[model samples]
Target: MTMTIGILTENVGVVGRFLACQLGIEYINTQPLINARPFKVAIAGSSHV
Candidate 1:
């Protein structure tokens, strides 16, 4: 029913979203991302911090 990818990098996230969208998987809300930096990524359903 859910698939929390647990990653939050722009490029990585783009790839994830692309794959998920193509595969018809529902992206998670707040995917717990560890060591989030450089890419300045943010999870869905949340504002950029």
Candidate 2:
């Protein structure tokens, strides 16, 4: 059997990155790929309260 996993987050924190590293997975943004498909990253005015 084969399996795959994915983690999606707006902003990855220290713990998130650590987990990704421990799992040997890529922690990155999809901007580069989306750039070719008319997608973009949106910045918020402030962090959620």
Candidate 3:
């Protein structure tokens, strides 16, 4: 059996890693696609408005 879980957050530094460790899962940092790009776009858009 195979299972997958994904957790999305603005910042996944310490807390995210800790949770993944406790859950016995591998922590993969997909920050650019998951958090960074959108955040940057939002910030840029807000600044422009």
Candidate 4:
């Protein structure tokens, strides 16, 4: 059997990214990972955030 890993995030942002690279898993969105899609590196909004 394979191990199951997970993460709890407020939104699709930087924290997810680091997880993607290190864990080699897909970064899911608002839904469960089973229904969610993979994510990539993208800069959104202004730097002022």
- What TM-score, computed on C-alpha atoms, does each candidate reach? 0.34, 0.32, 0.36, 0.29
What would the per-residue lDDT of candidate 1 be over residues 1-49, giving only the tens digit for each residue? 1234343234446665564565555554245263233223324323222
Model 4, global lDDT: 0.38
Clashes within 3 Å, all models in order? 0, 0, 0, 0
Best by TM-score: 3
Candidate 1 stretches greater than 4 Å from native: 1-11, 29-49
**Candidate 3: where is the Cα deviation over 4 Å?**
1-11, 30-49
Question: How many times do residue backbones clash in model 4?
Answer: 0
Flag regions of model 2 displaced more than 4 Å.
1-12, 29-49
In model 2, pairs of residues that clash are: none
C-alpha lDDT score of every prediction, in listed order? 0.41, 0.32, 0.46, 0.38
Give candidate 1's whole-model lDDT. Answer: 0.41
Per-residue alpha-carbon lDDT of candidate 4 for residues 1-49, written as tens digits (9 for 90 to 100): 0111233232345565554455555554455453333342222111123
lDDT by residue for model 3 over 1-49, one digit each (tens)? 0112233334465655554465554655466467544443443444356
Top candidate by lDDT: 3
**Model 2's TM-score against the true structure:** 0.32
Compose the digit string of candidate 2's lDDT tens values, residues 1-49: 0112122222344543454465554544345444322211211111111
